[model samples]
Target: MSTVVDYTTFAVGCLLALAGLISLLAGWAPTWLRHVERPRLFGAWALCLGTFCVTQLPALRTEVIKLGDPAIDACVVLLLISAAALLLGLRRPRRQ
Candidate 1:
């Protein structure tokens, strides 16, 4: 039962992280997305997902699951990276 919940959370976290990456790539590939707004939006999503993963860290660590810890940590790192990229994008001028 508990194991199932933990696995579910881990799976959700992975999905969120993947979505964040896709959002980031989409933002990067479009001329319209070159503006600050898109990146900021994506970054916010990433940050939220990251925070969610971080919040689950304790439970994940305590669980019997072997891979949860590393997976959650990776999600956190990816979110932070995405957030940083968003911040940097916002600092630059939008393409005309």
Candidate 2:
């Protein structure tokens, strides 16, 4: 059924969002807090979050008819802004 499909898609989106958040946090945390040294971690997080946003597209298009497109657009915009900020912060030169 459509309801079941919607729920499944939403669940997948939630998992992707959670994974992205965890990656972002791990990458942003101070060196003392994070154990891994993956240099592209933040970029990976951004990619994951972007994929999450893409997965939600169908539900935003068909299921949420009353709310219109603004909500989804807002979410995408916010994700983009957050990703940009993260990248900028990471790129800032370290002050000695």
Candidate 3:
């Protein structure tokens, strides 16, 4: 049952990864995504999220998430990366 759930999560993560790839390549987003000022960074964040999901699987989690250092788990790293990307993406460049 847990394996089945992991596979399902993996599928969703893959889809998110694909979307991130497209967004990164396009370097632009539809008007509906107006908030994504830096599409590439946003895409990077999405990719990180996808990876995080994949790392949650029990088999992978043992290798990816070191319980010894809870602060250094795969999910935590991904979250930090995504947060940085989001912050940088949202902030506008200052006018020279």
Candidate 4:
């Protein structure tokens, strides 16, 4: 059951990241810009989703129980930090 969940999570994460990349390119690139603006928002969400998948990956690859748990935990922490950064990035800077 856990393995199934993990695989699902990984797949969802990958899709989200890919979607974000496509959206970024679609929105920001002049040649292929999207009709909708605000690609960065999609990029940020994809980053967060990708990080969630990263947290799940250690157990799938590593046999060592000790190593996998730490890696997973670290990724979780990283995901939080990155999400915070994304939120900050989205905020408009105040002019003096």
Per-candidate TM-scores read 0.40, 0.40, 0.66, 0.51
lDDT of 4 by residue, 1-96 (tens): 887887888788788767667755665422353332456664655666675664466564464346767865766775785576456545365599
lDDT of 2 by residue, 1-96 (tens): 877776776676666556556666655434552433453465354545655455565746565445668855756665776566456545445599
Q: How many clashes does the backbone of model 2 have?
A: 0
Best by lDDT: 3
Writing each residue's lDDT as its tens digit, candidate 3 over 1-96 gives 987999998888887677777878888654677677888998888788877776776777776545556634657988789888878877576699
Ranking by lDDT: 3, 4, 1, 2
Each candidate structure's count of clashing pairs: 0, 0, 0, 1
lDDT of 1: 0.60
Q: Would you list the rank order by TM-score, best first?
A: 3, 4, 1, 2
Clashing pairs in 2: none
Q: After superposition, how far is residue 95 of candidate 2 from its true place, in Å?
A: 33
lDDT of each: 0.60, 0.56, 0.76, 0.61
Better of 3 and 4 by lDDT: 3
Span of 10 residues, lowest total lDDT, candidate 3:
65-74
lDDT of 1 by residue, 1-96 (tens): 876776677677767666666666665333565455555466456645754664474565555255676765765675676566666656465499
What shift in Å separates residue 34 of candidate 3 from its native position after superposition?
2.5
TM-score winner between 3 and 4, please give it.
Answer: 3
Instruction: State the displacement of the C-alpha of residue 78, model 4, in Å, after optimal TM-score superposition.
Output: 4.1
